[model samples]
Target: MSCRVGSTSSAPEGLWHWLGSIPHWIYPTALRRDGALWRQVVLWISGICLMVAVTGFWIGVLRLRWRRRYVGGAFTPYRGWMAWHHIAGLVGGMFVLTWMFSGWLSLNPGEYFAVRGPTRDMAV
Candidate 1:
């Protein structure tokens, strides 16, 4: 039989019931309930951090390119495309790295890993 919210029929236990009641748009496979103010704060902070890292990378690339053209001063004077390419690649790489790390931390909080054993106290 189809499931219904707040139903008392042959439904799953507390955890499963809670998981099933989540909205479909956010989580079709499982429930994703709204978080408290703290969680929202963390998310916003992570987002801002990601943005800062990306911006730094972009600026670093620009600095590197400028340094190469004026500082290196290759006698032959080759095309400047290589300088731009090298800096852009480095910045993009760093951006992706920061994004992945922050994303993982956001998905699972630190407390989740602090659990020692099955019988360990979870109230803390």
Candidate 2:
């Protein structure tokens, strides 16, 4: 039948309900019921990706800066595909770092503001 959209049940019904139910089909009911495990998995993967991205970024930066300087100039390293590879890695590493960091933060959502609680009395 008909699915309720807002207060009315006369809403157009095609694949909207099916599309919404896809998540249920993909993830197990237990995982859906308790999101802690899912969040932990996401955090672990994102953390690992973040570390890899950081190291890759450092290696790319170092190679582009120091290693290429002796050959000729930093920008003009190789005369063919290798030069493009170096440029791509340097640029792509920054994007990867940002994406992984954002994903990690998403799984570990926290409050930015720090509110202090009541302090204990010195007399007590």
Candidate 3:
């Protein structure tokens, strides 16, 4: 059985495919060079994404106070809020994850995956 990491089970097919292919994509991008403007954009997007992700995650998870309907659930009037919260959190989390990695690379272009100078060839 495939490990349903994070919110994978609920993720859309297209997104799932992309996420599945991350290992293949990461290396190439990690080594590639990015321009200054691109880096700024990445940083801005990452910041926004992180904020949205955290807020949504909190909202999504906080609703867990209400358990099974038949069982003794949390005594709250707004029980249905959980579903929407989860959806919002999932969406936000996806964007946040992408933005974060890309932003890190953009911010530290030289540091991330920087290839060292060629090593001197040892005499045979």
Residues 24-120, candidate 1, lDDT per residue (tens digit)?
A: 1233332224455445555555667666766666665555534445535642233478656655657576768666566747556555755476653
Better of 2 and 3 by TM-score: 2
Candidates ranked, most accurate by lDDT first: 2, 3, 1
Global lDDT of each candidate: 0.55, 0.63, 0.56
Candidate 2 weakest ten by summed lDDT: 107-116
lDDT score of residue 82 within candidate 2 = 85
Please give, for residues 20-120, the per-residue lDDT of candidate 2 as tens digits.
Answer: 66443335466666777766655665677688778877876766555436455655456678888878887887777787687667555443333456546
lDDT of 3 by residue, 3-107 (tens): 355664554664575566653333225433565555565556566656676776666555555455423454332446765555655677777667676756656
| Residue 119 displacement (Å), model 1 | 29
**Candidate of highest lDDT:** 2
User: Considering TM-score, which of the candidate structures 1 and 3 is the better prediction for this target?
Assistant: 3
**Once model 2 is optimally superposed onto the true structure by TM-score, how far is the C-alpha of residue 102 displaced, in angstroms?**
1.6
Best-fitting candidate, measured by TM-score?
A: 2
Model 2 regions more than 4 Å off: 1-33, 66-68, 74-79, 109-124
Alpha-carbon deviation at 4 in model 2, angstroms: 26
Clashes per candidate, residues 3 or more apart or on different chains: 0, 0, 0
